[model samples]
Target: MNQPFDSDLPNIDAPAIGPPTTDPVPQPFEVKFATRVDRLPPYMFGRINNSLYQKRRAGDDVIDLGMGNPSDPPDPSVIQKLADAAADPGNHGYSKSNGISNLRREVASKYYRLYGVRLDPDTEVMSCLGSKEGFSHMCLALMGPGDTAIIPSPYFPVHMYGVILAAGNVVALDVADSEMFLRNVAYTCEHMAPTPKVLIVNYPHNPSSAVIEPEFFVEVVRLAKKYGFMVIHDFAYADVAFDGYRPPSFLAAKGAKDVGVEFTTMSKGYNMAGWRVGFCAGNSEMIRGLGTVKGYYDYGMFAAVQIAAIVALRETDTNVEKQSRIYQGRRDVLVSGLRRLGWDVTPPKAGMFVWAKVPEPWASSMSTMDFALKLLEEGNVAVSPGSGFGQGGEGFLRMSLVENEQRLRQAVRQISKCLG
Candidate 1:
């Protein structure tokens, strides 16, 4: 105080004035995004596709069996119906967000015919751009930061990706068998704090080609009732079974509609992959939730596509059967050819895929990706590596039966030359 002139030297003894600052301020820039996007894993198919693009550009006759994309076209009559509808300029306006009434009724009737499951078209059914779109939107509508979902491992990427995109936690169960699935669901319900709110079940499952019996849905519905969780049954491959194996709908199980919803897609069944049509049926409340989210996000698909879907559902029984037989033939050709080359593989009872365990001298030496890429380079053949599905999918590979019998046989010959 006496030497006030030396204020700069003795300032350590005085209290600091105004606000305190520790670090340098950042320069103003573009806004930061929500943290959720960073949490997403890189899309596995996109990575595989990148490689495919590069090889194809390099002039390789890449036999692409990597994706489950349908190679065939829709029925000629369906196409004509679509064209007729599109010609009606009045039909080109924004369509109903929850799907047209006739299409919804057709969805209900189809479910009743295929599974003997009755549905109120107006209350329990809603159309989706595709099942994938409905699935992801349902996740957005139902889950958030504190909610969690139980998904079977080695699942279709969307089944899990939807949960992550919703900022919900995921609990995976190894779905090798019915008993394992039941035990895992019960255990998860009992042990996990803040129990899961949703459980996703896909039969004629992707990647693994695991098929579920009707009794499995009975147990699942029972667990859902007991644990107070919702079930999202993906019945996309219902019409694609083979060898006298008819996959039943989850809604056919008693009390299933009380605690869950089922998503069915025309993509696989009617060779309408690019048509972007599907439906969700079951718990009315859940359907309403999906509808609410979808209404805000979309005005629905092209009216022409919806009209054509009606024709597909009403008149495509023989076409569906023919497509199933085509897949079965491809499956037999590929499976038998691989076995002939000394690889142990099983023929799937449903779906257009063969899940195979990595075999022999290559199994121990190469990672799944390495094995897949080597096959692509050496065999000029492309198939999905199991690791792309999830960690549980490792030590295996998935081959799609999308090719015709001749092309499939050629693929097998190519594989034999590389690995056999």
Candidate 2:
């Protein structure tokens, strides 16, 4: 028989004896993790991302439509402003943890101009590294043991994991039907013992590209008042939409400021994804809670970036609108191309993704993860499997609109041949 792995230890692989030696055998120490760390699952995108990297290193020109990262450049005026601000010695120092006065004011002005929701920059607004960071820190600020957050099914990963990381529980409600989603929210709140402590909303939701109308938040505010739950609306895609369909701000609803805050970012609409300029507005009390957590955790965003952000918000509205049109064109190409492949897909009204249903025999024969792998390995196209979002996302694919129209068309052809 083969020897055991511990055979090098004294008497480990030898026959047992009546008496054993008293000499100590050292054991290799292992790093331990906290219970909190144990709560998280492996990153679902790691495998796909790693494979893409490996293939690229091997010199494959993979058509990457897996991530919603913006590929376009920021307005030249914004870039010039950033360079000018960065050159000033005073702008290099640590910034105010709640963001500089002018940046917050600019965010407030945008909200009023866009949605007619007036805000006090001093008390009701703060900047974040990105909306993702703001959402996570807000979870830490507001959630705790025994707290529960109601999130949408087929969710963006952070919406679910952020609450989990704060030692809170989650209840996901399916969001495919906007009306049914609200009804389920009411039903969940009415039944849960402690009721849900928070309700997280993402209109123009990620992965699924589900968009909600303004009246949705009116019902949300009413429900929150009835059940005493706080609301956090992730409005990351606030500035990106198609077909003249403007995405409404949650705070635009009457009494919304009494129950919730909205999170918006310049990433999608401004082609400033790398700048990490994000804002949280409405509900001063909630802002204070988030600001308190941030005080200990960060030094706030870079002042130069904040200055550039101010210029973008004030002067780049046209550029933001143009970016949305570009995404609309790309969406047309991707959705039409996928539909031609006999895939069930819809053109999204807003957001940067086309949530599509996996087609026919292949979908039934293999897991979504395997199907995605097949596309990468055989078709040289990278995609995100729906199951990565949650079980509710199974049998679907979330294709991002980041690639150019030509590249997306190429991806569709490759997908066609791979399945053929």
Candidate 3:
């Protein structure tokens, strides 16, 4: 046998690399990102708002209706709870990955009391840092490359983008009208590649503010069962509806737990956006799947935040109702004001947005981004260009009702001055 070479022998005497070559010619990285990642847009939301902010800072009085951030404060009780919990010396450590048991139990209790939806808090509920994170993780956990997720268009961009990020294809179903929305979903089930493994639905919808009724849930649950697809209902705006219209919980539908999961967040209802607290409840299997994925990724929301969220869930309904009323008042003012200026803006049924079509003079001549830029430059009104949401959202704009009624009225007045 050939003498075994001393593989471990260090070649210390080999040419003492002459003063380490100064920054060798930067070689092109041959290790490329996955094709899917390379295909993604460099930025999701464009630099429209940042540029508008700069312009506004330069003396333009921009009434920002671009983002659906709540301008109000959380309930005093909730804030006090957070403060008390934060003061506890022992609460600062890493939290449980699935969230504190107390929060989950409280969530289950609230669900049962409000929707008559019985849930085993241990298995059916998982607290999330936010509903958006919960939704995104669910898509990743339940899907793989070549899988398909049925998503409603002119809806939340995160739903579609999350599916795409998971190497899954999104079958966009336009939820423009009630009938067409349902039919599109049914059609997707009947005809789609890889047979759509997941379906995402958002009620008290963003941008559109369309509230889904119990009948819609019934149809959704039926389609889910028939097609054997997991349904993920985003109830982010569940507590934000106005005019006594209590939005129906997806769990209220019979057999909903057989194939669905619903995500609710404190961000909208309790103005806890920065707190990052939310919960997902429904089909135990889906909840477990999401929890499993999250366990691998995070240590859950902060313990104090979860404790504070428990307080919020238990005591913030009145605050939520008050916030809803405020938005409703602002919506009424903005809709009437815009209409007075000859722009037909439909008052949203729920959520914090007013989706309005671009007027005739501008609609045909300019894209949503172009019109939005022009409006920002001339009127100093910062509305979200609809095309940022999706292609179907083109020729429209989404104005958040987060501003006060006076500010909304002023925004409309500015628009009138610009357009007139």
Candidate 4:
């Protein structure tokens, strides 16, 4: 038996009702974000990440080779340096956004030791949260509306993302082969109206895992000087070469430092992916420009991380050699397994990826996206579809060698089953 409340009594919890007025109902608001943000392409990994999560939730063991996240841990000594620095109470203050002097000197020393490229630590070298951050900010610093930059096809997504975000136009040239790449660059330089403002290059390049000779960079520098364009060379895979191959820094070219800057990351060489430490060195102007933009955006990485990165740059040569061997071994296993199953795959000389052409059986039957999705379902193996990289990447797949060799072999076996 509940008593009814009187109608006249106040009900504080009740929603207020007012007499209808002439005002129209409030229509749902259409949110508008920056049109520059809309200009950027959708993240290509979202679908793959979602698929992997859904499959794993269903109790499936998907051998993942989708992302190039490093599998190895950094050297213990480097970690110890971080731990030691973290223990200091006074070391917790905001670090210099352009990086500490000692770390910048260490980076300069590294370039000099490895590439014979001398840089002024104070003016020409800068530290970044990672190469991606440095490169993106460099784009923001250098480019703007009505400017154009040249990017190779099947490029790292950020290459395009940075240019677009800067409101610069992108001219994507196919660099599938070395000679073709050179020819395209020359033709673009000769034919394009209003010569490009920047040219971005990567080696060992992602997805395709293409490596270039130091002589190639010499010619690139020549082209840049002639066309009056700046160059940004991403040498992130500087230490991931395989089979006695040593990747050279673009800055090693005689005139390269005059026209270009190079970005190197600790992620691949030092197995410090999550540490987010990298360096940009070469042209003083580019470094200063990026540093200016970064100053406004960040106070640099954690002091401990910067100290740890210094240790990695100064030490860790042996550790890098060991990791290279591990990636080489994984590359061997994946390449051999795929070849045995009648798929065409070339062993890459550098980088932690194998750019594989879709198997002949699936080539005619499916698009790269469809094939990638089907492989995840039937083979229980996840790979990045080539088209995810760009239009030039269509008809192929990019498989990361991030997993251990055993898992990579298992992935190949699973793919074999899918083929059957």
Evaluate all candidate structures by whole-model CA lDDT and list the values in order: 0.90, 0.92, 0.86, 0.90
lDDT of 3 by residue, 271-297 (tens): 989888888999998888998899999
Model 2 lDDT on a 0 to 1 scale: 0.92
Candidate 3: stretches off by over 4 Å: 1-24, 27-32, 42-44, 56-59
Q: Which stretches of candidate 1 lie over 4 Å from their true place?
A: 1-31
Candidate 4 C-alpha lDDT tens digits along 56-142: 999999998998998789999999999999999978999999899999999989888888889999999999999999999999999
TM-score of 3: 0.92
Best by lDDT: 2
lDDT of 2 by residue, 1-420 (tens): 766667457765467667656867979999999777899999888899999999999999999989988999999999999999999999988887889999999999999999999999999999998999999999999999999999999999999999999999999999999899999999998889999999999998887989888899999999999999999999999989999898989999999999999999999999898988888998999999999999999999889999999999999999998999999999999999988877888889999999998888988899998889999999999999999999999998889999989999999999888889
Q: Which residue pairs show backbone clashes in model 1?
A: none
What are the clash counts of all predictions, listed in order? Answer: 0, 0, 0, 0
What would the TM-scores of all predictions be? 0.93, 0.94, 0.92, 0.94
> Cα RMSD to native, each candidate?
4.4, 7.5, 4.8, 8.3
lDDT for 312 in candidate 1 is 94
True-structure RMSD for candidate 3: 4.8
lDDT per residue for candidate 1 within 176-253, as digits (tens), equals: 886888898999999988889999999988879888888999999999999999999988898898999999899999
